[model samples]
Target: MPRARPPLVTVADVRAALWSLVSTAAGLGVAIALVDGVHATNPWSVLLAALVVGVGDALLRAPLRRLARAGGAVGALVLGLGAQVLVVWAALTFLPGITSTSWTAVLAVLVVAGVVMACGHWVLGARDNAYVVGDLLRRARRAAGLPRAALRTAAGPDGAGDDGSGPAADERPAGVLVVMLDGVARPTLEHALQAGLAPTLDRWLGSGSHRLESWWARVPCTTPASTLGLLHGTTDAVPAFRWWSRRLGRMVVTNRPADAAAVERGASDGRGLLADGGVAVSTMFSGDAPTSLLVMSRASEGLGPGQLFVRFFASPFVLVRAVAGTVGETLKELYQGWQQVVRGVRPRVSRRGWYPVLRAVTNVLLRDLNTALVAEQLVRGAPVVCVDLVDYDEIAHHAGPLRPEALRALEGLDRVLGLWEEIARGAPRRYRVVVVSDHGQSLGDTFEQVVGRSFGDEVRRLLRERPPARDVAPRGAASRRGRSDGEAWGPANTALHALRPGRAGEGRVLVGPDRDVPPGPPAEGASATPPAAQPEVAVIGSGNLGMVWFCREPRRLGAAEVALRWPALVPGLLASPAVGLVVVHDDEGPVAHGPGGTHHLASGLVSGRDPLAGYGSRARADLVRVAGLEDAGDLVVVSAVGPLGRVHALEELVGSHGGLGGAQCEALLLYPDDLVVPDDERDDVDGTRMLVGAEAVHRRLVGWLAQLGLREGA
Candidate 1:
């Protein structure tokens, strides 16, 4: 037999535990209720988050107490905060389906809540040793001024070079260099320019080869949508990514964004939908296809846009982590391999700038940049080279886009861009550079703002109604009556058996709920009548994705449109202060409109040229000419308002794009009048045209190439 163990806890322990529980319960209830009162979330969602927190807290109490005694109060606080961060981070990462906002925000909220609870221990003096430790750590951190410290510059690899002799340039350029900027909204750029924050662009414009005007952006205004427009030069309405699977004929929404592997996994899982005996082709995922990806015939022939997207990139997360781990190792190895490459470059530059926070993410960017840079160097390139930087979007999500830290990150990115420009300038006469952002940044906590307050009382009440029961033994019979009762309505057996059947014939109908069934003889001539119809009860609202009436009608606009158009709903919901954007699905697509900062609408255009100018008119004509009869856009609207939208106080996000009337919808055209390129010469060009602008420029470029006698593929 096992030895008997001493009692783990005593009477005093029990009392403390009980007090903690009660205090915690009360505090959590008040917090959640207040959050609800502020219209943070509907009653049910608030209750759920509270329950999770409560259970999580209970499970952690023992460790917390032990840590308090060992670490001192200050140490205990740090322990608690650390524990909370880990727990919340794991929950958000592993079970993202349950996460309403980004993991960063969830971790923040969890820490704040845990800290507030630990303060109770301080006031109660439940654990003095731990409190002291926590205080010490706090003071130490404050004294160190850790939060505001500037990051150090990172060292480059010994052989990493800017002289165009690096491995990135191993592959020769293929004449034409096409760079696609995924979310560049013209209005957003104009707003940034008008704000006077970017002076570099003004100079670029003054250099010529610039055309800024109303260029139609991709429909749905997503990365995929915009990218497709640039690649295929058409808006086919075939979504690049969607929750609905035609093969499975079902809706399968994911809590997390799908990477390249996930797309293939989905295809494999749905293999049952494939046509007879054909093995899955490897070439499909290898970027071997040549023609446009939008044509139905090509899509059916195993050349799909889905496969193409995956072929060009690896999983983003994996790339980031690998890059981070290799940095220290790579620098050491490179320094040993090449002395000249390390001559002026610092060994620490690899560890500096955005490298520290983005240690895990910088690898993919390195590969992407290296590939573009190297390819262009080895092969002679065309006149224009467009470079698309998507890191801004990713950085903004983890750290607020415009936050000082994020700006610092952007500065690092700008430096990298400068590096690329420096390399291209080596062959300046042969290349022209254009750099841009897809859209602007907005700030806000994603989750709490959406789920904090929503749903109607009427909807909730309707869902809670119970159905009535039927079937019982006959009553008032001698065989069924109890000893003390004379012909009682119920029997004296089990609780359920005790009930008796009501009157037959006329009483069966029960015209009103208040009316009782009339008593009747149990003979052959009588039959029970049916009950009258019950009135419909009002419904109470329950949960939503941030919209005012989500649960009431989640199916109002269908699912696919919602998934594509309203990505913010999943990441921007909050359960406090009732701040967030509302996404509503429509026949056209998911339409978002709310008070908080989010890109709920398409942006406007920005142009130095008149709307009625020559090329501008021609561009308009081309748009009308290219649209097919079946999938043609019904109406095109230009928002007179600039890309910058109104910013509300009490919200973190300052701006948004994609609304109906905004500057984000506009395009910047920089085609010099003297250099009108022919359409035939613009084969390497990507993205849709501002007909007048693009075609004119194309004609001009073609003419220059003709003067040089360069052929399409030569």
Candidate 2:
């Protein structure tokens, strides 16, 4: 069959095309006037150059986009600039009245093109900006008596029942709005409310219409794991924020798109919490929603209605505001970091890297974008909308969880929530606001700072003290050998190795047929033989949680095997003052050991004092379940807690999660009082029961929607 010709361009298309041409011309004219030592005799010449450049760009856009997708962000940038430079050269050659022909002119054209493209993208490509413009248009239409009702009547039955009223008084709420404040633990938020840092939350807490409740997050309380579980109702195989997979022979970082997608796929049961005309914004996973924005798992897919870049750029005001805000926020973050340093803030990490930029993006750009998108969703009467704001989380990671900076972020988030609440009140459908969090953060000094050495370093020290054998080599020697063989073993790789099953405390050393043998001098009166390659060990730390793996073995090793291989390994780890608890798998089941006593996970029996005494009642069960995962490390270690309720993180984070200690496990949920919780659900330990995990939270939310008559039933 012959392919049909593309549809003829409409008047609107022509208008848009002309707008692009004019915008490009104006941008180029401005650039020419601004560039030093470059003169444009006639503005008409700049317009001619813009016409040439614009036509070229229009012709090349598809190919450029394709190249960008193929080459990634950096490669696409370079390729796009080079292509623009060529286009400018061609324009200069063909255009009349263009006197400038120097490299400086070409550079000016490049800058102009960049500015125009950036502004255009910021307005038209951004979803947040689109919503802003769309909202304004909607309001204008409403003001002119072209209300949503008229549009809905014309569109058909889908818009019929949205008259902002129901048959009965009980049937008030038409939808559910869930706001997830990432990393704001229950205790932290409560303190913020009391301290007046979170005025909106404080008001909500005092309001009789809402009820505040605290819940527990399951083990490995990271965003990916918690969000997947909450959205899809399961987080079966997710080990941690980052974990080594023997099946894949690589480390899987959940924040990465591919890894997040994999995790989403594994956890999903076809029907997600937001499957009923839901919208997910700024979340790690999409909850299988049809519409998603800034969701890591769905990032590879094309931009959805939730993306605000295009819409933002389309509105000059929003675009300029964002650009100005980004500049101001960048400086603000730098000043804040500097202030922290000068103030001698305790338990602070160096926020000198990409942190300042990331902070600005999350706090200013992302926060505003999310607020706009959520308001848009509410106005459009989305059945269920979930948005994740992570400003406090990012700030808390560098500063302490309750630090003034983090508190300020919380205050900002509370204001966004207040805006959402106000928008919901005016929305086409009544919305029951639900506020929750994925997980909480714990504040303390890091293990390396407290112990004066890294976890991997201590493991290496223990390995070096032992005699070298065919299966065991010094960690330093192994690392050097691995580097020489082109298989470099860095700290991260060493952590992965330490979590595997093999000879205990082995550093990452590659041993194969092609491995290079280091030359060495003969011992006294004996011929020298190159040292046997030691198996690599990885000692990875996520927050206070640490995993020790022996990489030489293909399968997870039992504690007995580890003990037999390296007798001093367990003792050395236990002796470390920073290590509070250690759990290792045995032939029977997992066992938890601590300075206080040992707990047998299988029977929940304690040999001496309980190892999980101060952690919580759920700690033993949570640990046992995580230890049973197939990809769990050979040995799991948790940092000790001090008398003042501080836990040491394995990573250099001041505030962290992914282990049981402090306020990390405690999370919060604030929902309207009208939402009913069934007795059966209240008793449900990990499911529809009270909030035990993200899945339970998901269930409760669905139930609330059902009660509000948003869905058919729970």
Candidate 3:
């Protein structure tokens, strides 16, 4: 038996396996570099990563194989891939920023690395192929799909090939600008893109640009989701509004992490983050006090970036909605303030005009974004300049989209764009500019009027259900039952219950839990239970209704259950013909259910269009189909091209985007003949359509660039 024992696997075998794995990874990486001659990492660093991967594979091969055999080969691939990625990541992690200059050098280095990796794979590793290598390349390409050239239509149909026939990509253009008009759907934007509003855009369309359709926006039409998607170039791990109220007990509009932090803090302190105490209670009625002052005064000093932003915008309307409960609180404040004034006590000046307040908020937001843009330009100095205007959106929300106010806002944004173009033109550089929108808007009524339901009624009903609810009190418990009657003592749980009978002396029977006094015998002298009280419900119209219920306390049920309420609330609202969508919220922000409720965020970008078109699609996602850069929309609601498609309309909020409607989802991409061809057919890039505008424009641009021979300086 001993003599018949087979030879044991040796270190040489393990080494071979390790080398194969290394070669496999290297090969794939090289393939990526060759195709897209842009690397955020240096060639030396990449090589170093390759070497580390080789070493790591050698060390982990036996273990990995054993684990793979035990955990399945699929598991092994996962483990191997993870390790390889880690090695590459580690190599780049400690390094500073990366820059790329020479395409030839990059392509050559990638090729060598890829070949070595392939050899290593062949020797020691698994059965990954050139196809696998290509897959990895595709992933990288998708990640970097949003390129300045692609955005500006400078890439052409085949996508900026590195050949002597074409004009040097460097000589093609300097500043490439892309502006998105959020919520302007495909059909809506297409009409305008086809119409000659901007001469540059018109040229692109006339030349036949490659066109791509059907990229989905994330839910909810929130700016964070849309902008982040645009910046990241994909829809994975989107930044959606956190719906569950963890900290404040109820969700109005808080992001996820904030909700979690609120819950945790509430648990620790035995208090809800939403607990107003004195300040929150005071500001609701008259809207005078610095509502967030109390919260900020007590918060920790070293807050994170998000917390900092929240802290900056923590007003009452910005914070919690306590209209009903705060009535008493407001009375108290007025009384106190009057006493102070009579006694010659004066507080500081107030910035409280409604219009001025709106203006101030917009101004601050504009200033912040502008500062960020300027700083980025100064630091990066990239050839492309993308500007997103929010003026149209701001005015559209406050004033109807079609109103003069909204138009004024659009004009202002145009002025800003004009100034930007002027600056670009004056500079010693050439730039190509493109503008787009996700959807268009409708005009008619307000969100409340269109939906025919009162959010106030819903709030009251919810409070009545739990009379101990802060907003409602039970019927006549105090008057019917004297303070001395302990047996009859009970809180007036709801406003309806507050009118009920209490004890022996109590006259008429009323709605409440316990009797404070004996109810008078029924009219016929028979002891009978009184009829249940019914709270009056306000009129609910044909349009939709949205309810945002904030929780009063932080609990596990608070987060999960409150968010779940959106499902129950939306169906009823959607029953109306005019009510197509409903978005509910609690402490976590917007809690939505149904196919239309929970979705990706919409873009906050503004488009360059006629005033009518620009304001209509303010908050919708901006669906961008350009390659090399991320599209600006998260959710796109496409509406019909014409007025017959009109459903629900409002004044302050007549239209919004975030759904996959005809108008909000579809958009236009106009490019120049020197840049693209507008083609309707979708091109598969890693199984996803990577369509541009049209074929003719793409061909013309490619041909023109090739004839120019700028790569060889002909």
Q: Which parts of model 3 are misplaced by more than 4 Å? A: 1-175, 183-218, 233-242, 245-380, 383-385, 426-444, 459-578, 581-643, 647-652, 660-662, 667-714
* Residue 381 shift from truth in candidate 2, angstroms: 2.3
lDDT of 2: 0.64
Q: Where does candidate 2 stray beyond 4 Å?
A: 1-173, 305-309, 465-535, 679-690, 712-714
TM-score of 2: 0.70
Better of 2 and 3 by lDDT: 2
Which candidate comes out best when scored by TM-score? Answer: 2
User: How much is 548 displaced in model 3, in angstroms?
Assistant: 7.0
Residue-wise lDDT of candidate 2 within 1-714, one digit each (tens)?
A: 322332344343455457656766676676667665345678788778877775675576556656555443334435555666777777765677665558777666555554554456557744223323334334423422333344323211111123422212123347778888888898899888888877766765564556777767888887767878778887677767655555543444554444556678777766787887888887778888888766766655533431233233323223334544566667887898799889998877666655666677677666766776677777677888998888888788778898888898888788677556545544555567788888899989877677777676677677655333432222221122111111111111222222232431221222321122221121112223321232366556667877766655677888899888877777788888888889988777999988878999998889888888877667887898888886678888888877766888776677888888888877888886666555555433324335687777878776666666665545
Q: Candidate 3 residues 35-87, lDDT tens each? A: 44445454555555555544654465445545554433224435654554444
In the order shown, the candidates' Cα RMSDs to the true structure are 27.1, 11.3, 26.4
**Per-residue lDDT tens digits of candidate 1, residues 506-547?**
212121111122222212221233222211211110011111
Models 1 onward score TM values of 0.34, 0.70, 0.36
Error of 2 at 75 (Å): 18
